[model samples]
Target chain A: MMLLQATGLVAGYGRPVVGPVDIALHRGEVLGLAGPNGAGKSTLLAALAGSVRCFAGSILRAPGVALSWQTQRQPAVAGIPLNGRELLALTGAAPAGLPPWLASRLEERLDRLSGGQLQFLHLWACLQAPAEVILLDEPTNNLDPDGVAALAAAIAQRAAAGAGILLVSHDERFVTATCQRQVLLKGAAES
Target chain B: MNVELLFDPLFLWPCLTGMVFALLLPLCGAYLRLRGEWLAALSYAQMAAAGGLGAMALGWPLALGGPAAAFLAAGVKNVFEEAAESVRGAAYAMLLLAGWGVAVLLAANLPLAERLGHALSDGQLYFTDQGHFFAALGALAVALPALAGLSRPLLLSHFYPDFYRARGRSARRLHLAFDLLVAGVLALATTGIGVMAAFALVFIPPLAAAPWAGSWRRALVLGGGLGVFAHLLAFALALVLDQPYGPVLALLLVALGAGSALLAQGHSRIAK
Candidate 1:
């Protein structure tokens, strides 16, 4: 079943920044959105996530479908003292399938974790959250090779669990490796 | 020292009101500090003070007028949500300045202006009336449970508002609800304890507790405890030394907050 369909979508902060583009996601499919800087990849994701204003288009979701979005920038966790386990709990995500090393450190404060560790942890929270559709932007930015591998595996697992995934990334190799199909966004004028 | 005075209703009511302020303001402060809206508290306090002073001049009940004015100020702030951060800062500063300006102008015209102005700046907690006490208590009643119920979501929203929104929560509404609550609490405190005391209570405790707390929840609890302890200690000192309650309490909180920050730094170095 189609989980989300965006037809003739143009999204941006104020002025039309990205598209008159068409996109759709089906259940259990992993769709990669890739483009160069200023391609409005993030803006497209934001429109789908109902964040950015959709200048022109329609976003249709399957009835009662829920979405989980991981933005390019995670919120600052300093001084919060929340641990990985608590973060998952707050999001209603289970730690059952997380990497062993990551699972073991769930009790540690989020700020105490290295950048890569924290990134994966946050990604896992979004992936494992209860939602029909998951949106991830620049999930590989701070990741190491191992973290990237772990994320790819997790994405596959989530897809296998019947969730539709829309991933936005600039990493060509990773996108080609993990996504079943790719959507390329061009600059606003070009498109 | 007149220990008997401490047992009197005049002294006891203010202390009770201060205790309530100590309990509520720190919780709001913890979230404000986390969201980088610490200045909003001071601005709201000033607006509430201005409202209270205006009420006094018009012979209206301060309990109603102060909250109304603070809520109006909060509404003005809401309109600036999309403005640049610098613009928002300017808006807050302007509200504070306007509040003080209106207060001073009104005080100058009133026969009791000198006394009223002193209370506005320094606070006259000892002169708290039954109406102010009940109003503070009522605010506490509403604020405590509301904060307790919303603490987790509020914390999450502060850090990841978009994430919270994506999860089907209205982050904007949550923010507005929080601001309104803070404004209400400020109105009560400003009318009862004065602007200086209210501002000190809202800003200091969280700062003092920030260094040692491992989590936001712990920081809030610690901050509330610190606020209560400081209020009590300062009250005792004021009674013995016949010093002003507001300045003494504010100074004590500042000293403690600085000490906490230093201690946290020392502890971090030692751990390293």
Candidate 2:
């Protein structure tokens, strides 16, 4: 089934920003979004996440389709003194109790977690959510090679488990390795 | 009828109603405070004032029944305040101040005004020494208990554990329930414009306590205690000075704000 179809999407800041582009995501598809700086990658992702208003377009999706979004910066602070399990539980993504192995492994503070571990936890939170599509904006921006590999592995696992993945990234190698297809948002068109 | 009206159950009813309103407002304030929504409490007080005024103008039927009427009036106030605060402090202040101004203008008919004033606790201006004193006392007695009960919840909701606890919980339901209860209680106690008197109970203590209170409990307790003291003292002062009680309470609140700032400075010095 077509999970999300964005037809004739014309959205941006007031003064002719970006879009007039079309995109579609189907069940179990990994679409990599590649673009340069000021290329409106983040705006596109935001529009898809429903955070940005759609100026002109029809976004059709199946009912009960949840979109999990990950930001470049950790959206929540670790200063609130909640461990991973508690945070996950609070977000309603995980059960109040987890298996011993998973519970023990995820006990690290969000700030204290290694880049790779934080990446894994972020993905884990998304994976555990009831979302059918995962939207990641620069998922591996701060990660090292190993961290990126761990992220790639996690995404692979998620895609295998029947979830659509949409991501915006600059790393060509990472995109080639993970994404089933690529869409490049080129420079703005003439008015 | 004139001599017996003094001892009539109807006469005493307004006093009892005033006392009950005094109690319910702080409960409403505490609930809003716990939600970390001070602006909400202020908004509710303004709303209550407007509704209470309107009810008084309309023959004051609600106030006749006393506490239950006061509660409904308070609920109307809370709801209006909630909507006002959702847009921020400016909207809330404008509504409250504008409403008070309109009420004053509406009470221009001296004879009708006198009757309405008597019906609604003297349009928030209890001029006599005893009337003012009871108001002050009532303000304190009502505020203290509600603060004592709801302090924990209010404080916790702002900090760590409470934040986590509120996660995924439907706090709005709890809020609506409390608002309804307050309104019901207010309805029972208030008559005519006297219902607006609840504003003194709802806001003064928390506002004064915010900057001066060292801990949450201390803030709530001190705020409630001082609110009562300032109110009573202000009312007494108003009677002695031949001033309006509403303006007296308002001025005292302003002074309390200044005094709290000074006290904060002195405390800091003593600690040093």
Candidate 3:
């Protein structure tokens, strides 16, 4: 059975402007959502992950699907401060063991972490979620070469273990290295 | 009048310690709110204030004021705080009616008992006196331990998404716990009397700060600052107005909140 499915899903923030397209993710499948800026890449990921309300159509999913959105902005919680490990753990995906560099980096605040560190840790945390399906938005925004490589390796490992991975990214290198398939949203033509 | 009571070690301890705790609670709350837990903190603060007011009213000594007037204040705060988002539009109206009701009731019932009723109405019912100030300070002290206690859960929710997700612990629980505690303390402080003024403390300062406070820390600092300013201002205003001090203070806080909002808006627009 497909671990996740979104059929004719349409959603947006203020107005209904995003999608009515169909998407499906089977276990062990990794899909890269490719699109131009404002092409609803993040919005689509939000809808699929259940963070966003679907304007139309339906999203079917396994019971415990967890989404660790690489939100374009910083993550915040009221009255408390947090670092990388705490963020991942808050999202229900703290990796058991990190390569020493990552472990040391996690000790620092997420807001202060280098972009690359933030990107790598986001993916690493998502992969650890117990959910069958995971969604990430623009997961490669701040990654350096090494960070990109680590993310790719982590996604690959998780996919091999039968978790469905969905990500939106403008980084062609990241898409090619981590994703097995790509869905390009041809703007204006479909909208 | 009661110099010994004012300096009583027990009374002074809660008052002095409470100010310290009160000051820190918002800092922690601001941090949590910045991390995206404002809802939790707000909920807790509201509940705690309501319960505290009720307790204060119930425990109120007739010698200091009396129970009837105390309950009136608690009733107002309780009603004001519980109304949800949809009914928020009605807060001003509700608050006004509460004030009017208390005014009418006092005037009708205490026609012969002028000076005593007026003093009690001012002090016990409206938080206009030094005693109320001391009590508010003490409550703040109480909140310090509560803030420290809530920190771990709040931080875990912020940094450890997995922990939050797995535990399904929304800061709502924290808010509820806080609200209940505050309400109890407020009950004790007001003896059910100074609902309107207590309500002012909870809402006005934060509302006054929200527009200009770009972050939670800024908001909390602004709120706490406003709180102190309002209390001091109310004290001065009461002395000047020669009316019951608590109502006058509540009105002043509202005015200050409005002025702050206007100033913040103008400043933001000018900067833009």
Top DockQ prediction, candidate number: 1
Q: What is the full ranking by DockQ, best candidate first?
A: 1, 3, 2
List where candidate 3 sits over 4 angstroms from the true fold. Answer: A64-67, A76-81, A109-112, A187-191, B1-272
Task: Highest TM-score: give the candidate number.
Answer: 1
Whose lDDT is higher: candidate 1's or candidate 3's? Answer: 1
Per residue, candidate 2 scores C-alpha lDDT tens digits across B1-272 of 13443344433433343333433455455445545454544434434444555665666653333443334434444455435444545644554565456446555554565454444543443322345445545644754564454444333332223222313233344445555544443333333224444555565556556555434445446665665576556555655565555556656766876787788669768876
Off by over 4 Å in 2: A50-58, A70-91, A95-127, A140-154, A170-178, B1-37, B63-87, B100-272
CA shift at B197, candidate 2, in angstroms? Answer: 10
Which docking class does model 2 fall in? Answer: incorrect
Model 1 per-residue lDDT tens digits across residues B1-272 = 76676666667777888888988898888888877778888889888877877888888986667788899888888788767879888988998898888878877888775577678678888888676678788888899898877777877666556678877798667777888999998877876677988899989999888767666567778999999999999988887778889989999999998898788789889988
- Could you tell me every candidate's TM-score relative to the true structure? 0.93, 0.51, 0.54
True contacts kept of 2: 0.00
DockQ of each: 0.58, 0.04, 0.11
Candidate order, TM-score descending? 1, 3, 2
